[model samples]
Target: MNWYVVYTKPKWEKKVAEKLTQIGIECYCPLITQVKQWSDRKKKVEMPLFNSYVFIQIEDADRNSVFEVAGIVRYLFWLGKPAVVRDEEINVIKNSLKASNIADISVSQIQVGDKIKLETGAFSNQNAIVQEVSKTHYILVLESLGCVLKIKYK
Candidate 1:
């Protein structure tokens, strides 16, 4: 059996994993603990490592088992088709994440004050201060120009 990434409906990874397991399909949904502070009290909560997704090990021979699960949006798809996630990659992802003491914060994936150096262009060698970080680029304070410039980190 090979592992496959399953995209689930929003906030449904655990729901889907439970449903899948009920039908006898093995699945993995890594979770982390986080403290949720409310106006009145704080509570610790466990949340999925990857929101809206889980990894399941199944074979093309057992495709129907996956479909039997409710709330699985679909086996992750490519251009109009299901895609396969390799066993090794899945093992690496699962092991590496499980080994870390992860906190389940809904913080932006990108953070301010990230230490980065320009890799290319005229500012190649300069150490930059990340003024703002975005999904597509980092707004950096170009010390030489005394202005902010966005660099595509991807």
Candidate 2:
């Protein structure tokens, strides 16, 4: 079985993962704990590490079974096919979260128009082209993932 990326409804990642698991599908929704502050109080909440995305391990022939659950929009596609995520890539995410020190990781200097491979974060191990860079953020085009990523720095 290969791991496939599933696009979920906004804010439905956790719920979708839960429903998938209940139906005997193996799913993973990476979550991170963040402190949220409101006018009245501050609280630590666990949020999905990847917004509107969940990873599921299933046979290719059984791919359509996922739609039985609600809140699933569609499978993320790349190059006219469902995007496949390597098991090692998934393991990297799991291990990194277990360590909980990923925030301390840093990247070296990069310039606009440079092709770089990310070593950490959600897009780790993927190649990206530097589209734009500024003092506040970096805009990267991830061809493999079919999306642009904006990374903010202080």
Candidate 3:
């Protein structure tokens, strides 16, 4: 069996993985626990490590069954063939992510004109570019729609 990457619909990684597993498909969707603060309280939540992507181990004959699952867009194809991920590489990703704390993984210094994916809030999963940076916030520009958003970090 070979490991393959499947592209899923927005925010559908978990669901697709679950459904695929129910039908006897071996799928892995790595998730990370995040502590989020709200106005009244704080909660810990699990979110997909790689948004819109799931890994599956299967034989070539089983490829068609995978695409039948809802929310699965298609297999990630590279160079006219389904992209195959090595087992060792997948193991490294899983092990590294499991050993690190959320804080250590989340903090990164982004610069102007750097593109980033919004992981939380109303702009979740949207891609934006850094326009300006302040002490506790970033002024981001959404290029596709020509709008600017001010996002504050806690």
The lDDT per prediction is 0.65, 0.83, 0.76
Which residue pairs show backbone clashes in model 2?
A: none
| Clash number for each model | 0, 0, 0
TM-score of 3: 0.63
Candidates, ranked, lDDT? 2, 3, 1
- Please give the distance, in angstroms, between residue 79's alpha carbon in candidate 3 and its true position after superposition: 2.1
Instruction: Report the C-alpha lDDT of model 2 over 1-154, residue by residue, as the tens digit.
Output: 9999999999999999999999999999999888999999999999997899999999999999999999999999977899998787678568756873344434558878899887766557767788887766678786655566665664
Candidate 3 ranges with C-alpha deviation above 4 Å: 100-154
Which number leads on lDDT?
2
Q: How accurate is candidate 3 locally (lDDT)?
A: 0.76
RMSD of each: 11.5, 3.2, 9.1
Local error of candidate 1 at residue 114 (angstroms): 17
